[model samples]
Target: MRSSGDTRSNSLRNIGLIVRREYKNRVTQRSYIITTILFVLFSLVASCVPTVIQFFAARSNSQSHITIVNNAGTTADLSGDRLLQYFNSNLNGSTSNGAQIPGQQASQSKGTPHFALRVDTSTPISQLQKDVKDGKLDVLLVLDRTANKDVRFTYYTASASLSDTDLTQIQTTAGQLSVLDKSSRLGLSPTQTQNLLAPPVFNVVYTQKGSGNDSLISLAGGYFLGVIGTVLIFMAVYLYGMWVAGGVADEKGNRIMEILVNAATPFQLLWGKIIGIGAAGLTQMVCLVGAGIIGLLLQGPLSAVLQTGGTLFNLSYIHTSTTLLLLLLVYFILGFLLYSTLFAALGALVKRQDEVQNAVGPLTALCMVGYMASFIGGSVAPGATWFKIMSFVPFWTPTMMMMRVATNTVSSWEIALSIGILLVSIVICAWISARIYRIGILMYGQKPGLRQIVRLLRQ
Candidate 1:
């Protein structure tokens, strides 16, 4: 019998060899090479989508010139310049495709304005309407008062969509103007009118302390990153685990397992196959991630060169940290090991490659359950009690925990506990898989029943 030290060394050496072989084989395949290249390109392009859109938007935007026609002397109280400033404030705060630039005012205090505002009390109503119809004016606002002395606004646009932001802005401004006019007519002092128009002071208190006041974009980015992380984890596990099963089945069908078993222990073969294929998947994943990062870095330079002002597709909103990425790698490795071991064992039970899928059906279903649960929980509520509990489950831990991590909802202790459970679960799965693999690889006829497999394990 070999010494335990020698056996340990031999196992490690064999696992290393297997891992390298498997990785090389998978990566060297024409399909695998093409697929990896395509995915890398796709990820890079996808990351720059927001930047491309912003570039086009900056170029394509035609400043909508609005000419207001006041028939009832609505500007009698407020000067035309003040009215124009108010309208510009309401409209140019930001544009549809543009992100809000910090420290930039809507008045073009430092940046370009989106809307041009001017009043034309001198122009005849007929001429103004004609100008609007002729597309000389993007919008025409006709203002008057009703029998109740309330300001009446008539909005005209030749090509205004039902969901135009300008329409909403005009309506909001009209209401404010009507209030101001009424307040002025009440014979109130300027201070009283200003006080009446000012919003009431209201303070907000949080019941639960969060990760500070993240912007809407940041909050959305966190959610987006979480969903993407979960998806990547799921695909790597499911797709590569199938590769493990298919490979094992193919080897058994060709009677290569007999030769391989003689060269190495069943345990070594089992782990070697898992590690080998996992390395290949990891390589592809790394390329994809690196490409995405490269694309993100390129956005600023691209924006400058194209003169799109700046990258609106900023990833700064997503809280990507080294800890998060490391955790992602940890969970992926553990999750892949936990599932692929079972896939390997199941593959050994099959008589042929085609039978592998049928043999692994139950495991596939269980994996699907966890995948669907993670996606649903990630989208709906990543911090709910049920989601938290589910994250601790070995099957769902990787994806669900990452969702929590990305959203900054899970505590450090929880992450530790989840990873601990997953590691323990992987060891347990490997043990059971090793047992099944010892006997199953040699069996060439009909698959053994649960009772027979149990008896085999007992022996």
Candidate 2:
């Protein structure tokens, strides 16, 4: 009888050969290279979409040109020139060409000032109205007093479809103007008006403390990265898992699987193919990660070149920490290994490449549960009881746990527990898949019934 050591050595040798064959065949394909490149390009483009749109939106001059006619005349106990300065200071907040003017409060609205207010007392109201109608002026502001001597502003715009932003902003300025005028009539001094109109100090502070590398991650960026990380894991599992099933189905359809099975035991073949495809998938993932890093590094220059001033979408929220990265890699591998074995087994059961999608539909659905749940759970409550429970489930552990990790909400024990469960689940899955694959590869005809599948597992 052959020694157990010799049998073990032979199995290792056979597995090594199959692994090399499968990996080389997968990575060397033109389809594989093209798909990887396309996915990288698509990822970069998708990530930059918000920045690109902001650039286009900013290209247009959003400034409102308002020609003002101050007919009420020194109602606030100030000269026309002083009223002009007040309007300018309040509306634009003393910014020149997007640069902050010293000794001036920055505009309440983001970016450059919204309204460029200029006195046009010399010009006839008819001419100003005509200018507004002809689009030569953005708006015409006719300032007058009501019957009660209260300040009133009548404005005309070129288009009725324009946003209410200008109207609302001007109303704020006008309201402030009325306040000053009223304060003056109440015998209040300029210092008291200044004190009364001053805005109170307000700021946001996060009370939660970060643990270890969590402090290195951005608050908003952590959530954003969680989203990105989850996406990367989901795509890797879904795409690469399908590839594994399709590869096996293709081999079976071409009759190469019979030769492969004869050369190696089904258990060895199962591991070899899973590991091989996993290696190839890992290669693709590395490229994706590199591309993601490069894309993130380029965002600063991208924002500068686009002149977006980093408003709306802030990439700073994402801080890629070494710990988060290592955890992602670990979870990514475990996730793929766990799913790909099942995909490979399903591939063995399918007789044609065309049937692969249908055969693996259930696995896809299962994978999607975690995939979609991570998005909702991560956004809603990464530390919720339900989320924690789901994260421990082997099928979802890769995705949901990573979300927890990215959010910096998970403990070391939780990580260990989830990983431990995943490793165990993978072992059980691989053994079951090996048996199914051994039988399914040789069974070339009608689909096996549920009872036969159960019997094969029992044996």
Global CA lDDT of candidate 2, please? 0.81
Local distance difference test, each candidate: 0.80, 0.81
Summarize candidate 1's per-residue lDDT along 1-459 as a digit string, tens digits. 899999899899998988888888889999999999999999989988877888798778768899877765644276566666656665665332221111223434224666788988788888888888998889999888789877788988898587887777677667766766777677765556556666666555322234555555655677788888888889888889999999999999999999999888999999999989998988899899999989988888877777777635566778677888788888888888899999998899889999987888898888777778877887787678999898898988988888888777877789889988998999988888899999999999889989987887777
TM-score of each: 0.86, 0.86
Cα lDDT of candidate 1 equals 0.80
- Tell me the deviation in Å of residue 76 in model 2: 5.5
> Roughly what TM-score does model 1 have, to 2 decimal places?
0.86
Q: Which stretches of candidate 2 lie over 4 Å from their true place?
A: 1-9, 75-79, 93-116, 147-149, 183-217, 303-316
lDDT tens digits, residues 1-459, model 2? 899999999999998998898899999999999989987897688767777877877777587898888898885775576676667776766333322221344455556766777887688999888889889999898889899888888989877865777787678777877887888889887667777776666555433335543443365677777887788889888998988899888889999888988788888988888888888988998887777667766777899887787654444567667888888888888999999999988999888999989888889999999999999888888878899899999999988998988777788888889999999999999989989998888777977767888998988
Which stretches of model 1 miss by more than 4 angstroms? 74-76, 79-82, 85-90, 93-106, 109-113, 116-118, 130-136, 186-221, 310-315
Per-prediction backbone clash count: 0, 2
